[model samples]
Target: MPVAGQTVGIDLGTTNCCVGVWRNNRVEIITDYHGRRAIPSYVAFNETERLMGDAAMSQNAANARNTIFGAKRLIGRKFTDPAVQSNMTHWPFDVVSGPCDNPIIKAHYKGEERHFQAEEICAMILMEMKEITEAYLEKEVKNAVISVPACFNDAQRQATKCAASIAGLNVLRLINEPTAAANANGIDHRGCEKNVLIFDWGGGCLDISLLTLDDEIYEVKASAGDTSLGGEDIDNRMVDYFCIGICEQILRDSKMPKDQVHEVVLVGGSTRIPKLQSMPSAFFDGMELCKRVNPNEAVTFGATVKAALLSGVKSEKLSEILLLDVAPFSLGVESIGGRMITFIRQNNHIPCKKTLTFSVCKDILPSVLIRIFEGEHSMTKDNNFLGEFRLDGVLPLASGQPQIDVTVYVDADGTVTVSAIERSTGKEKKVTVSHDKGLRLLSGRKRGHGYGTLEMYKLSD
Candidate 1:
């Protein structure tokens, strides 16, 4: 772990990235060379070739093929995933297939064709944040605590950690985005316990978390989210509505062909025209919605505030916080007739264990199928399968006589381990499942995966 003095809190966001430091007994946001506190997430590679930020936001209209945005939607997801497939259909930029059939963005940089993973795109943004912090602190910043969406799964979290490595950062902790938001909101209140629900609606995802704070311990009681729900949907809606208006105008004027107008309106910035500034009104027509926060800046602002709180310069007493975050979906096993028998419910507290015992219905039933799933759906086909294990070589026993005990344990880090024991024979089998892609670091084999390791990313004969 890096020393506290050398550590910083970074909010690597989907729309923008912000860095904060502890200085003069308070958290301070670092300003970039451009004098901007928040850096636009947009990135562009120009003809002569230079990467640009805020300056690139408007250039997308002219060089749509070289500009990239909303890469967050595809990060850590398989190319075959429904959400990624759906986004590829309408994304302005090109989505090409890459490793593991993952979606990679292709763009022209300085007359050279370049391919980048979503993680690499995010890493570039994080690197910019690191530059801003290092310039402000006048020292090399090595360690950081990064915030991720509360409902991010093991794969998504791992992907973020990998991006941190690519950005030349050592991630000390992966804090939940909502928990960080609640911390920024002062949920502690001098040790008074409180339950706060964080409803995070960002450009590419929606996360809802139920958290409880008690005497410095913050626990997540439940978490749920839709990977495809967010402000991007609203933007698409606006784009569609704007195109309709453009087509109607062109038809009224009889000035151009439908296909040409369609092409022009779709490729140009005309889609960003806020045709219905009142569109937000339709989002919460019946519910008593709080004033809608700025969809673009809220996550960055919240992250900035959190960075300050963790800088140790801000002295705020926090109530005990206990967070029991759940798997995004329910977990279960396969049963007779291809049915799913749920063993653990979603949103349950962590550090929990559950056990089930089954007797052999037939004298020669030598194997049992253990299927794991995640979701509320009762059918096995409707849920996401974590994996499957098969227990074999069961000793033949009288029907309904001896029982086999199966136990499943889930740890704080969302890892699931399973063990099975034959009650009469005293035979046992156990396995530990690791969702962390870089778990080899736990053995102290090397410092922080191969990113900075001379043996990993470096070329050798």
Candidate 2:
């Protein structure tokens, strides 16, 4: 029923999930047993067993407290996050802090209390999609290309990959939603140099990307979005809008004038809003918004193309496509004076590496603490803390004597590896940021311009 070595593409969305495959020289949207092309992103628990998709959504009215929806917003987020705090007020389900300060879903099922992490809930949804696709093709599927919001940080991207692993799916690649939409629009074969802007206003998030295309080479020049601005937010606030702000930010980041944009593409369900439909056109000075691709299936279509390319399918149209993505945020280490020294700036091409050298902050310091962070802020406290590691065996020399080189490497899949090396002694320590289980944060007051002693910090696990 299916060809050998088949791979699928999944658009794991905030409101629905869609799976597609590149077959018969075209993309086909796989439907579940009920013949539904799109499934609601819901999971629920009852006395007998668990329910997912439409069935879970049907009983949400009766089991509101146990039904978990909109888990995407909470994935890889701390309980103390302001977004989580704001969501607690509207969500019927219970969200509590775990030992690691991550949000955990509390529910009662089968006469017992159970706690499920956001990743686990996402895994359940992914597993359901896998089963649906398997049944459709009458063969087991293992590899997939998943899509995420372009604004997703390193932690969020890693958490999404972890969920795929839990569902027994090997991630071939994680494509940005807006980027995928550009692929669905078939911009690579347009046969000219053009600058395209993608406006992706979805159910729970808004992602905007500006890209340049020439000679089958597609590169993302800039990206900006807000997770809190979407269709649901419009229904909740009834008075706030973030489209103008996002447009300004994207223009500023790309350093391109509005008139220079050759084409504007619109995707996502929320783009159907009359006000939203006109916002992009107005911002681009009356440029007609391109609607060649179906808003609901654009992401899935792009993902399927990526899967086809990854699977080595012999399609002439996909043979020459080259994709070059960029990091969405800056990466760096905390330095003396509590400043953030960035080694990798936002919009830098992926699979790149950079290194910076520093000197000892204090005399006779046996070790130096390297605190990794992600953000655009100048101070360490204002940025998002990734993790920390101590590089020991320093030459125990006076301040500004020992030379320590810190290198940050990000692969094509957004995996981060940080290494610290002492030049004189050749001592080294390294860590993979995704596997970091705990974070060390400053707990004491700042004294002078140096990082305080190790004892003044506490473990956040």
Candidate 3:
């Protein structure tokens, strides 16, 4: 029994997950039946049934190979990716390359061998969040605003959305984690101009976002991060963990002087470490780190507020705020001489569309292939291959006779949709390009299954 307007915000983190909702004029963290606010992001399979959250995590010692943690690290990544390959050595569980070259976890469930995509494992965690929310609200809730690291590319973002769909939740939006932290602090509502630095060091990633606020609009100036570096790394080398390198890197990349940053807002559990906290203070020349909001819960709080706003909840404090995000990397397609032609450059304002017109290289071409990629590299081979589609029935015109428009559109949530059109015949071929053909979630491998195709679901506009 889903309530029409029930919406919640989910912080689907690498090391943990939290859900919250706007209630009684403020954000309230939804607790599980045991009254725990934060839940470990772990899923385990055993003799009789699958376990989630604490249940899954507590038994991880005995079921290390069957317990799945850090699935977020594998989501939307190719099995051949250096990062994935590197992580594989440390994980106790087995990961095999899928047909699409994506990583798939293999574990024993009910005395049977089973394989699961990263998206599926994440979906189980998301389903637990949905159930927790439903239990708290006493009604079925479907819509949510989930947060991801600003560094997540198109494929990672779409895979996250796909996980939400599998969990039976409609994503109102996929927000950047640092941006959500800023909202939790009501930075835009402060009504004063300032340059704020948000340092988000979580379990699996560290996102540094520099934002400038004017009136009520918050524009992200620049964002930089190491997707594979986070709190877990710090824990491994607690004695020598210093984020000064990344702090200086972001400042250099954004070209912002340390003194100019009015406030250094800290997000994620890692910021609580005194050594980690001191590094930022020293780097910024002793400015106090803002800790007004709970480091672990700020993301959830902001997401809840955003969910409330999207749900059309009437609240004065939630209104009159605008947030603008940027494209983390340049998006383009393979062109002549194996080069890449960028349609959307890195740091470009999003919810934006850019089009490039071209003609077939061959005089009488039947079709043209659009091999899309994302990165700042000059060649497609050096960039991350996103996906591709073929536009056929081109009318077999001469090299320069046809006008084909290749349009790359990025929505506010950072999901990408690419389309190609032939103006002459008004023929068009469009795709979201985020989902790989071989990596699509298929409804199979059953012991009673209910997985759906990720591309088949889209949140209402």
Candidate 4:
């Protein structure tokens, strides 16, 4: 594909959004109309009109219920996920349950009820980035390379792609957040074949990746992350500490209705009391919150660097830069004893393959079970279940004989393919793993048999 004349790099982030354009063989961050390097990813609508960015963030105090923030955590997640339920506990806004139980942000704007899916909220931010790039480059901007956390799963990646579609921008690629940042920083140490670990700490997530750079190819060796750990976690800890101190102070004062006192004390500004500043400072050990990287703006700044590189505006000396990213979680199958036998570790290189051999515990095992799981945990129940498959007709083999060989391959796009062959009969079965919910959302696919309307399932629930 021919590169668009106005290609730009965008960091569509959780708390804030930024845009970068290539110029004079370097990348430049474009300030918004308000002359800010970062624009708050917030939107609000008062009875009179709609507002966005800085103006919208200011309303967080007065209209906390209507202001929308932190939609990134909700993106690409099902309503059934425990993570979603946990996030709802801290969000000040009203999150309405949607189809598939996904959380939808609802607010009143211009005297009318306004509803937005997580995708739409993110699309609005991307569209703002598009406008910033177009105005900065003084041309029509249509194509872009947007970055996402390496640990994001297939559903999350697809959700981001959907957001791009709704924003009317063509995504050149869904680059990994940390890899893009490394590119932005001119880290091309791969010629020496060194193994470098990239630790990405952002407002909403923490991703750690190890890569082996050799010859012009960057290959991921291992990757891991805690999606629920980031700057937000630190902030919540501070908030809770503040709440505790305030409760103590209230108790010291004259006794009042407990409910009334709780209402007055637990709101916004009380959470930011400077007198109890030890909470935030104590959370960070000697100003270093976590090892490997800082949680504040490392990922965002790194993303800006990547955006510049992809725009082709960076110097040719830097153009040869290549980044290889790995899947964030481990891939494995369940064994007879419910043990998860891992084949590919997170952050391993793309276009790679690994195989494992297993013997039938019984003389005539009729069927073999293939349970796929993702996570760093060695135990089967500790990881997320991706899908399952069954291979039949195991040749009547002696107990403890190697009857089947399973080969797993992961492509560059992060698709997983598994093949199982019976050694004695040579019978084989293969399948490409896919999320049941995501497959249904992709256009032009027939609904699976026995599947009913989404509403019917809701009614039964």
**Relative to the true structure, how large is the alpha-carbon lDDT of every model?**
0.59, 0.83, 0.83, 0.63
Ranking by lDDT: 3, 2, 4, 1
Shift in Å, residue 200, candidate 4: 4.1
Q: Point to the candidate with the largest TM-score.
A: 3
**TM-score of every prediction relative to native:** 0.69, 0.91, 0.92, 0.67
Regions of candidate 4 where Cα sits further than 4 Å from its true position: 1-6, 46-50, 80-82, 109-115, 138-140, 187-200, 208-224, 235-315, 357-371, 388-407, 412-461
lDDT of 2 by residue, 221-247 (tens): 888888766678875233134777777
Q: Summarize candidate 1's per-residue lDDT along 1-461 as a digit string, tens digits.
A: 11454667776666666676655654466788878876767877766644546877768789888888877777777788888889888778888776556677888765667666777677777776776788878998887778777666656666777777877887766666655655554432425665544455555555555555565666665565566755666566643454244324323333323232110100001112354223322322422222233333334434444444444333443212334445544566666566777666676666678888877677877776666665677688886666667777778888787568878777654556777777767677776653333323222334432122322322320
Instruction: Choose 2 or 4, whichever is better by TM-score.
Output: 2
Hey, what RMSD does candidate 1 come out at? Answer: 11.2
Candidate 3 per-residue C-alpha lDDT over 1-461 given as tens digits, one digit per residue, 9 for 90 to 100? 22366899999999999999999888999999999999999988777777889999999999999999999999878899998998889899999987768788988876777778998888888888888888889998879999999999888888898788777889999989988988887632586788989889988889888888776677888887878888877653542443666667667767888888998889999888898788788878889888898899989988888888788887777766789888988999899899999999888888899998988888878788998899999999999888889998887777776489999998899878899998788789998865644334444433333233322211210
Summing lDDT over every window of 10 consecutive residues in candidate 3, give the lowest-scoring window.
452-461
Clashing pairs in 3: none
Return the TM-score for candidate 1, rounded to 2 decimals.
0.69
Flag regions of model 3 displaced more than 4 Å.
Answer: 1-3, 187-189, 235-242, 395-402, 436-440, 446-461
lDDT of 2: 0.83
lDDT, candidate 3, at 385: 84
The per-residue C-alpha lDDT of model 1 at residue 206 equals 53
